[model samples]
Target chain A: MIIIEILRYLFGYIEFRAFGGFPDRFVNLCTKEGIPLWNIKNAGGRITACTTIKGYLAVRGPARKSGMRCMALRKRGLIFFLKRNKKRVGILAGAAVSVALIFILSQFVWSVSVVGNTTLEDEYILSEFEKYGIKVGARISSVDLKEAAQTAVTENEKLSWAAVNRKGSVLVIEVREITVQPQMYDNSKPTNVVASEDGLILSLDILHGTAEIQPGSAVTAGDLLISGVIRHRDGSESVVHADGHVKALVKKKETFSAEDFSFYKLSYENKRKIIFFFGIKIPLGKSVPETNFSEHKSFLESGEMQLPIGIITQYGAVYSEEKTNPELSFQDKAALLGGAMYAKKLLDYSEIKTSSVTEKTDEFGKHYEFYAECEQEIGRLQEIYVEKTNDIA
Target chain B: MPKRKKQQNKRKNTPVTPFNPETKLEMLGNRELIIDGCKGIVDYGENYIKLNTGTVMTGVCGDGLLIKSFDNEIAVISGEITEISFVS
Candidate 1:
């Protein structure tokens, strides 16, 4: 039924009224002539009906023969509708222009986004893309995205994999950075393992070198712990990189003095004030009185497009200094000062085996002395350059 | 002459069968009626509509009888139909 209605609309139709003469005879004549008519009704001496435009034109002859006068009341359908709204041409023109604009804009990239990059900056990736002619506003058809991605991965040593994709007007570049591994010295070069610090050798393990020093041997800084020069069976010598781990007992010492100290205790007051400007906030309360307080600032972002304008809140706390008086016996005070000195010395050693503290008093001041024996790695790699000799044998 | 008279007598005794024309009538609830193979409208009023179907005449008695559509041999009638009857 809807298809028939649409067809009627396409071909155009007419709603008409007939009066006078014999209405029944008029209907019979219309049906006989195959002039389709619908929605026919009679009220008093008048008859109303709707028919196709062609039928309406053909209907006049039958209507005349039946002695009825017919008059079309209205014309309907797409053709008549267009003719009625012909003067309003701007609407149709605007629709066409908008469709063309959308098509043209979609063929070019409006923005470029970079994702999955950590150490490599977005600017660096964008610059690389620019070198390959893949930039914002560039025609999508002209850019070879696959070749661009391959170039991006190969040009940057930090990137292991890279992919480029286009979504509507946006071009996205995704990159995966290579993980860094610990540095390993070149084994092909001749190098010696030497003592990094002065100590008595506690243990030694040589994997690819001759031992230059034995356990319990005293050595100073820069002394060779393992020799890269190897003695062959034929009384000849060959140089290879030395690899070894040497643990040594190193001694550390420090001195401290008993003194009055001042410590800062920090507390925050809840009082705050906020001033907003263009979605950004400027806090205008009391400033921190001392430098010992911690400050926390938070920024609130706005809009789905992530506009730079946002609210900023600054939280501050003030610190007040409290002087402390020493309330310890003579020996206890000396031990307290000695512990402080030992803590400072411990940073230089990996592990402390034993320690001792001593105190002395003089006219200058009361002093505490501390000493500790620490175990630490003492081997350091040093490259050896050997001159090339003509004798290959 | 006797055979001719018997034939005439047989013809005279036979009953005349009316022409049976194809007519389709569809009623939706008590609100609308669609008549196909309609020949013409015999009578039309606010409360009643009578249609000619060649062999028989169909009449619809309603509260507000209206012809929604009529084209070719089809007619769509809509109203509060109270009764439908055929007049031979």
Candidate 2:
């Protein structure tokens, strides 16, 4: 189709009609100008001459000499070039055939891609598309891509939202998987105090169950903070596990350090671009001018053209990345560690946080230390202290 | 540069006859100019109009009229003047 437009523009073909005796005068004038006489065709009373720009000038003199009037078959300034001495019959037929072929090929699907699929594989999603006749090389114009995509997304119980996009020759199927939490069940089992971490208990509170330890109590791993038991007024005892949480204070001590070497540098580079014909890449821009460049690229294959409906053609760009890293100074290192310490504080509410520092500056480098006392929540177990008769409330 | 030379040659060739309403001056190259009643050529960048030889016709050259000599050649660009009668 594009080739035909280019040919038509290059050839500058125009149709001209003459009334009265202008046609014969024009033919005679053109013949005198070295133009072959057989090139002029007589259609009805109007004579159409396929001649070059030079031949058109040859007819100008005779046109002025004779009072015969002439008008171009097409509008003025519309024709770019007129093909001199070429057969027009076969040219028109060939153009029609080419346009028809392009129109027909535009109705089919060429490729399908699935994105955002973690547990569900791309093959599985494509198989679902096949069930709806949305596979590669299928006629996409006739299929409802939205309906099929919605049905496919709902088919999986894990998917919350699904979207299908048709761009050019590529079909993009995006699925948003639904997150499910573990189901909780009601059970009648003894609730024991479980140690969240290996820490010594500093304080404890017992509202219903018996107190297992007092303040400043030293406890090891998995030491019970409170006992889940009940004493009735009838001199009878009924032991029931706690259903609510209890509060406690514990001291946690941890130490960490590193004496490793790290290097810093900057990166600079150029990335390449790809040229495509139809839906295929033809490797256009590869050899770049520089080195030491970090590059990342993403391709978009979705519906930009609608002939084959949801089929998309992939167009991509390469992004060259540049990074800079500088060596840390004494102040800069302290500031960096200060931000890290703040982040650590956000993770846990430390009661008393402190840092012990020692600096050694030589040809190598310098280092420091950071220590913190973190106050955190530790779970406790409690039971009802009321008798069985009071359980009615 | 060549175009400039051609223009200079054309100006040198055109004759400046006296304001005769009936006569017309035609220029050839820088070498020659012709009036309705006379035939002559110019030289270098000077204002002289020398006539061809062996002709009864006559006209003013630089400041005065010069008669024809017998040894001059008759050519196509320079022709013999016909109907050289005085106009009122």
i-RMS values of the candidates, in order?
2.4, 26.9
Model 1 C-alpha lDDT per residue in residues A58-153, reported as the tens digit of each score: 999999998999999999998897788788798667867999988987777666778998888987888887888777657889989999989877
Candidate 2 ranges beyond 4 A from true positions? A1-98, A101-188, A194-226, A231-258, A261-270, A275-279, A282-327, A335-367, A373-377, A380-393, B1-88
Candidate 1 C-alpha RMSD relative to the actual structure: 16.7
Query: At residue B63, what lDDT does model 2 achieve?
Result: 24
Task: Tell me how many clashing residue pairs each candidate has.
Answer: 6, 23
> Against the true two-chain complex, what DockQ does each candidate achieve?
0.30, 0.00
Where does candidate 1 stray beyond 4 Å?
Answer: A1-189, A200-207, A214-223, A258-279, A282-284, A287-346, A354-357, A362-364, A382-393, B1-88
Residue-level lDDT of model 2, residues A1-393, one tens digit each, is 468446544645444555455444454444445543222343443455444445454555666654455565552222441232146667667777999977876666666778888888877777877787677667777788889878876776777888878886568888877788878843244454434544555555443455665656555556666666556689886565643333334443332222332223333334565543233444545454434333332333445422222222233334443221235565555555545555566336446434443344555544444444444446543223443365565
Worst 10 residues of 2 chain B by lDDT: B64-73
C-alpha lDDT (0 to 100) for residue A59 of candidate 1: 97
